[model samples]
Target: MSEHHEHRHPHGHEEHTQDVRAHRGHGPGRRFARWRHRLRHAVTPHTHDSSDKVDGALESSARGMRALWVSLAVLGVTAAAQAGIVVLSGSVALLGDTVHNAADALTAVPLGVAFVLGRRAASRRFTYGYGRAEDLAGIVIVLTIAASAVFAGWTAVNRLLDPRDMDHVGVVAAAAVVGFLGNEWVARYRIRVGRRIGSAALVADGLHARTDGFTSLAVLLSAAGAAIGWRYADPIVGLLITAAILLVLRDAAGEVFRRVMDAVDPALLGRAEDALRRVRGVREVGELRMRWIGHRLRAEVALVVDADLTVRQAHDIAVDAEHALLHAVPKLTAALVHADPAPAADGPDPHLALAHHMTA
Candidate 1:
């Protein structure tokens, strides 16, 4: 996603405070204004160029696409190898793995496209940019992995209920070894690229590759067990592998769904709240709300500052609060700091007092 940053100057901090007062908008705009105000005052102009960031993201995206191609190729080769082993060994579990490998290949195409799209800029209508595409692609990958696991588990259950004679275990074991090595290579490369680009889609692709390696290891052990005279061991090992896949699926599904629904990470919210509370003039944080807009975190924070301070002082404190939240929580893209005056010498403001009582 594209990130916007404003110039900050210490002497012009007062001007920024006035501009924030003139802004009257919803949570998004107010949050943007708060960030702009703080950023416009806290730091001076820089001489360093930003072309490196753009180049790095693009290079990462390209690497992810290349890794996807390699994964796809390996999947096809592994699937063919498994098919040959299944035919020679007459093993239902091996046949199921063949199908799973083929399915993994199918997912690589869309995931590659998603990674590329995630690098693009946002249009006027799509202000958040294309980061959500990566999240959506991750969801698709998780679903496919879940389906493969369930299907493999079902096949293993049926095979366990009805025993069959399996042969050529050595061939199946050799194929599984090859698949494991291939998957390892893809997983390592894709994971590095994903982290570099900060692309969830590429990360999901890497996870899929790692899963393939585990699946291969399980299948290899099962083949060896079948050769060693424990006919039931093959299906048992297959079931165990399937169970592992299901566990990964559960976590991936929950994370992707949360992102899609704009859910805020609890740890991030807690950090933001803590930082704002620690600001110089802030007495407490009230009405704290936060969510994910694309890959960026946005927050709305209502805070109580000293009423004795001037408006400019309160605004400066609010700016500090916003800065604290953003700096303390790296993922927080924007924050809206609403400065509430504390109680007067005689008593609290009547409206604030009534609102506090109602809230309490």
Candidate 2:
């Protein structure tokens, strides 16, 4: 990726850096963009387009990758700043928050890998390509969130059992504010982009960041309380932060579990039905099935057609329905349309006996 980016600018080195940085974002952002370019180069294992059908899905993955990279940089800087405060102030609460920020930064690693893997072409052994890896990445993120909650709770309990002195109250307070501002900014940016791209995992990560911002506020309160000569406030605030983390954990776990079980929005099904009905020859839509493969949707639709229509005619109708569905449904990669003959009052049910969904 770095090599590719470098080749885009063959002019004078100084002017090239300034142009690329301006194109990316902030004027002085060239250094950071260059850093991200190098980081992108390190993680992207292989590059291949799955198919023209998945181009939209691939674009979503690309947006997700960019979000993860930017968030990682923000959180890393936030955690490092807090760590310096923790060392000088000897504040247990600030230390816990710093640890969590670090963990949140690392969670981006798996998601970044998943996005790269999703771009690979489908293989004989894995006909769906590597998109499911994003779901796996979601699982890793949920587990990471859970582990952070547990660690934070344990640390708070230990601190409560043996209270310790805290120094540099003003500095601790300043660091807490910095942490909160950084996380809140990241949370809003990630959630906004995630919704636009239809990525549940990225949205969950955004919620996670929002919760972390609240925890940082709790640390700020601890700093204030300690300055007022309240020794127990540090442990109490730490416990509150732990509770906040647990709340975030519950929501994140639910979303990850839903994706793992292949749950999808009912509204998406309605759109699929609407699309199929638009086809001229479809008599009655039936037994439609849909699932999310990562952020992408795939569907199998069954519908009734005129009993007098020949087999070729039914196939053509199915093809037209498939095309309609692909256009109507958001992020739909493939639609398997199975046409059935109109109901017959006589004899056995041949509809169930015949093989359906023949793809070229």
Candidate 3:
């Protein structure tokens, strides 16, 4: 086989300059670095400029968010009523639902704002854009869920240790039913918003609401049990709800934390790499890396090609490969392809020669 030579084009310098500037502006290539780290950790193969679709999706999300606010308000009022009714009836379970309502109200604020922010254009500072706001908001909601769970658990345990006598069971029972219905409506609205926006945060909020709704049902059942002569059932149900909430808190908090830490789903990376490999002239893919930055998938892939190809040819191949990946991965916001000539299977390492050349 004849050995071929690689030559750099005059415009190569210009392209390198632009790539450097873009990387510098985007925060020290942290996103790219993370992408590389995840790819190195897992090697696998598996798994749109539809702006009109994005716009349509966002519009639907906005409408859902608006409905979410109204539903939350209804839930809050219902919670307040439940609190009064429970206190009058001496029902601790209803009191716990009040705390749940308060958490739901607080999380709704961030979720609504995140939905709007995710659709906004990129600023000079955030070149890749604000799509990650929804992810951050989801993180906030998860943290709140954990905190609320812990507090509720502690309170439930205390109440269980020293049970209180019931007084106005019917009033508290009525309030619990109202709260359950209201939360269910809000939860469904949030779930719809999340599906429309592809927002993990909104989905988390919806799931949180579902948990609360379930909790309310349990409280209602306990109140009914109390009225039917099972005086201890109310506190027992509250304790069980506390335990279930803790488990839910763990899952929500863990997922949100991973997303915030820029954890790329391995399957997504494999799919991207496989797509890039399909491009012609791409001899092999070295370090294929990817990460989620807000709503955009930022990828930095190292492509191996024939060492004999001209610089322009290599550059063109890289560009084509990148475009292919972007088109294939709807979530891909941006990509950086580093073209590296394939090294001989058994030959002198290029690094030593390059280092010597640099010193000379």
Give each model's clash number.
Answer: 1, 0, 2
Clashing pairs in 3: 89-168, 132-294
Q: Which prediction has the highest lDDT against the true structure?
A: 2
Worst 10 residues of 2 by lDDT: 1-10
Once superposed on the true structure, which residue ranges of model 2 sit more than 4 Å away at CA?
Answer: 1-54, 87-92, 352-360
Cα lDDT of model 2 by residue, 1-360, tens digit: 000000000111111122222223445574676576456435643222344345556678889999988988999899999999888878766787898787777777887898899888789998978878878988888787777777767877887898877788899899999999999999898888877766677777887887778778887888888888987887788789889888888887888788889888899889778767766677888888888777777788787887777776677677666655655676666667777777778845654544565445
- The pairs that clash in candidate 2 are none
- TM-score against truth, every candidate: 0.67, 0.80, 0.71
Q: Model 1 over residues 1-360: C-alpha lDDT tens digits? A: 111122121121122223334243348876887677656645743112345434544565677777778767877777787788777877655666677677686888777777677678768987766767777788888888777687768877887898666677788788788778877777777767665544555666677777777788887987778788888877788788888878767766776677677776578778777766666566878778877543345677888766676776777677666656655664454577777766677874635636755843
Clashing pairs in 1: 8-40
Query: Lowest-lDDT window of 10 residues in candidate 1?
Result: 1-10
TM-score between candidate 1 and the true structure: 0.67
lDDT of 1 at 36: 75
Per-residue accuracy of model 3 over 1-360 as CA lDDT, tens digit each: 112222211110111112221222236574685465346324532112345445544565566577667767877787788777766777656766787687667788887787677677678998756767878888888877777677666766776687766657778778778878877887788777665545667767877886787678777877787788876776677778777777777766766677678787788777777766676677887887776655445677878888877777777677666755655565564677888777788865545556756754
Worst 10 residues of 3 by lDDT: 8-17
